[model samples]
Target: MSSPLHTQPLAALRRQLLSRDISPADLLHSVEASIAQHDPAIGAYLQRDFPTALAEAHRADLSLPLGGIPIGIKDIINVKGQPLTCGSKMLAGKFISPYDATVITRLRAAGAIPFGKLNMDEFAMGSSTENSALQITRNPWDLTRVPGGSSGGSAAAVASGTAVATLGTDTGGSIRQPASFCGIVGLKPSYGRVSRYGCTAYASSLDQIGPMTRSVADAALLLQAIAGPDPADSTCRRDPVPDFSAALQGDIRGLRIGLPKEYFGDGIDPAVRAAVDRAITLLEAAGAELRPLSLPHSSSAIAAYYIIATAEASANLARFDGIRYGHRCDQPENLRDLYDRSRAEGFGPEVKRRIILGTYVLSSGYYDAYYRKAQKVRHLIRQDFAQAFAQVDVLLGPTCPTPAFKFGAHTSDPLQMYLADIYTIAANLAGLCGLSLPCGTTPPTAEAPALPIGLQWLAPPLGEATLLRAAAAAEQLLA
Candidate 1:
């Protein structure tokens, strides 16, 4: 039997289109068929407009790099005329984006079609896609397990062949953790590497938009299409986007990779450790050098990340009050009542918990004690990475503590859920580039199925070239 077109790598699909072996319409049909077959179980998409997507594909310019490719977008991103729900009832069915986000615009200009509104955590707040008010996104590999969040739907879609590639935002491991859980390549670019003008803010200082794909080369292609300085976003970097595709051609000979001692200490699953350790061994055998290093501040990453992220989320989400747009209280006893009722009715438990915590931390008496202290710790975390990068080309580690967990396993304990991203949050805090790709799988038991383990690597700001090169080499080695 022939493989599904949607299951093929983006580069292969693009080549077929260019050679007249497949048309954009054919690609769209393949994606639609996959969505029809798989999405009911995976719940990857919150909304899909295949009629419009097919129309766009029909007009796609095949000569363009991403031409005719359909990229699924996490719901938080603003795609003109599409729902921008952020997986919360707060904006669900209420807000339709009036303009394209810079990334969406760039994708269009590169001949890619933005096809679906993928599910996510409410306002990008949760560690599991379960926080999405709309639906639960299960790991494609295991129906009972969660695809990690807040980019879970993006990861699920890509893993399930519902999308050729997708866009996801990372604020404290949103992209990488999900990629790990879903067994795909998830790259979180440097904080300013991609414009955030159209993406809904989670943690302003840490949020970055990036690609989730089936392969490293596909990720490089998607990054090439969407990356560059954007004048609309003041926070976007002015640095020229490098040739990411070129980076993939290089080998990892003589590469210096640091394995932070703190990450290897404890709390990691034995299978996860073995899988990552094996990857490290492979890299070493391929002429790469491994050094044991310490990121002492890593222990405080979860704490600092929560404080700073929630603080920023609080400020950003305040705009959704029941007045101009989004969900609103039907009959307001008064202005305050409207605000209270709308927010209370709209937000889910996890989002409300975060907003409340954020509000308290930023409140008069606690600001200096919690929020300010967290920023200091964040800076220290960045310094730690700077110091480490000074000594090594990249840092290698597990993307998360374990493989994807069964749904409801960590739902009751938010702290346990938060710890799932222990290995990934620091990169966001430090403004470094990070990528996660599958290394190996755990041995399945009677109770659970075999699940993929992820190997992660981090690079300094704008060091995506190094990061991708290493990841591409690792991909080849692992394959």
Candidate 2:
């Protein structure tokens, strides 16, 4: 029999805690037990808070909505008194966050306990966790492969059951890709749907806070807690977040689901195509209509994305000089050396590469050619989505054209690796919401497991409630 803590659904989980059938302390212990067994092999957490988390868990109010569920916060986001290094060597020993980020404050108010800070790619710039300056977060199913990135560690934490849910930023494919690899549910809400006040910026326009969890319902529960406007972040949406958990009844009958033609072509793996086909059949069985759609400029998404995203990253990361804090190299002769070495010694290779590319693209003469052209292409991409959604309620595609690849598969060539995020970059560039959910796991009868496959579901800005209601139906039928 499964433990009461393990068997309970979100509602039952909360109920058991409220009735004292399972105390928050016992749940925290289970979390630690899970970590002690899984993390060494998985690299899920950047830092674990045992005594502190247990103490907080002890005081957890069962009446709270999240019910004292343990949460893993990606390290780039602030957690009071915990390290927010953003997973780089420069921030090796940095300590203490004096105040909570807006999202952090909200999570606490919802009665969730933060168990630890998870890892990520340096400065949230890469698609694979392999680029992490500190550690590589590997796939839970197959250690040889990556748990997609830059929110990799967060995905792995939830996949391995180290924490019930986690918070991550989706600047590009950061959250969804990793969630896809880990076989869980991840949502990158419409840009500005959640406040970015305490979250570190990757690309201001592209960055959004979101949840990565074991189920769509759990992700919905978290969105309810975190999705409201905050005075500290002017970018936040003023629209009220409807009761998402209540909205997930899973009736997708007659809903139009688009199958983007460009997303189903040559570069995709056979296994991935097969998995998405099965998912579509299941959605069809659920009474949804699946039709072919097109996003022609989709081919240019990576080229345009790198140009815009890196330009923003280069500017956002300039503040980490020696004088300001975070990380500082000792003994500088002048301000120039201080800035030069602090950044040189501080940033990882992938970060430096992006910063260099961004600087080159934005430099005086090239801006109009490379950067401006990319913007025009961005408009074309958004228009493509606008045209498609006019006929479809939700668009579907492969989250990644292939399953988790072996570590070091595309590390040597940046362009080759960027293709891994092709299916996802368009959503970020269009400033829309998208999700990735487990459709199937390969080698159905294998003793050890190969890797899992995912299906992508996308909708216009602020359509998560609708998108997830459709996904909830699929999840049940697929199971």
Candidate 3:
């Protein structure tokens, strides 16, 4: 028989722990058993420390805020004494984190246990876990399809009942896209809203760590534990964190939801469009006033995002050059050869591709033409959101253009894979808070399996309270 705790939401599990109906050790064991039974086929974890987690569970304090919940950490985030591989062979066994990230410290203070290092795209550069040098994490909804990435493992683990909740980093839709694909809830807190001190940098300006859970209330609970300014990170915002759980109580009676006309264009899949349309109707019926809006710069987001993200990636990934730690070449003919061979052998294809593209855009002569032009366009995109927010409380749209695709479907075509993030890249570009939840499901056809559809909600910076309130109401009405 399955453990009832495995399927219970995070809020319910906390209640059970408070009532002494389920002990932390029992919860850990139940998760371990589920992982042992399901993970080989699902591939959601890169590494797990069951013994350490078990030891922690035995001494857990149930009176704390989290009630000893077991949460999965994305491999890119540092957990003291654990392997911080970032799903790349370059740092695979070479570096053990010497300290915990700020978010990990906050989680521990809240009584949440960091249980495992979940798989991700190597250096968080790809749209699918297939880019991981470590393992391929499959979507729990359909084993043959990808759980959208680079946060695929976190999403897959939660969807498969191996975890109650997990943390994922979003650099251009990594968290929300996967949550959409796996039929779960994922949030990318506004840039600077969550500390990035110990997270492996992807695109520093774009990456924000957030929660992945089965419900909006659970996401709120996790966010409350980790969202605050950290002294170690200069980019972290100093705004006081709000009571996100309390925010979920009020209905979105007078909320103004903007439906961007650009998102429903010709390229979107028919099923996805239909599902989002239904969601808009449901929200409208529940007292949210829907208005058709325009983000004129939306079409140029993908192009600008690639140039900026890759350029930041190129600068951030220079630390892994095999000098101090990480993998090194056996014997170098010279200093140049050492740098060349080590990087070539250490990085996977996708990482190499992004690095090269980034370097090209940042090269001396081309910087003004490509990188500068992209930055100018990025400002316009942010301005577009600013104008839209002046008229609406939040913007609503489809999370992805389509449901999860089969493995190898877009592997050979980088452009195709990049376009998959068309609907989500703008939020990251604008540095706005975004959330994705299961709005509906597509029917199975002879050629494709049934898959979940997600509705994305975007709010201005530090507007998580409004975002969660609106999302929770929609979740309840949809249910």
Cα shift from native, residue 427, model 3 (Å): 0.8
lDDT by residue for model 3 over 181-242, one digit each (tens)?
99999999999999999999999999999999999999999999999999999999999999
- Candidate 1 lDDT trough over 10 residues, lowest sum: 1-10
Put down candidate 1 lDDT per residue, 287-406, tens digits, no spaces: 999999999999999999999999888898899898988899889999999999999999899988888999999999999999999999999999999999999999999998889989
lDDT (CA) for every model shown?
0.93, 0.86, 0.93
TM-score (C-alpha) between model 3 and the true structure: 0.99
For model 1, state the Cα shift of residue 60 in Å.
Answer: 0.6
352 in model 2: Cα distance from truth in Å? 0.4
Q: List the residue pairs that clash in candidate 1.
A: none
User: CA RMSD for every model?
Assistant: 0.8, 1.7, 1.0
Q: What residue runs in model 1 are displaced by over 4 Å at the alpha carbon?
A: none
Instruction: Provide the TM-score for each candidate, comma-separated.
Output: 0.99, 0.97, 0.99
What's model 2's TM-score?
A: 0.97
Candidate 3 Cα errors over 4 Å, as ranges: 1-3
| 1 or 2, greater by TM-score | 1
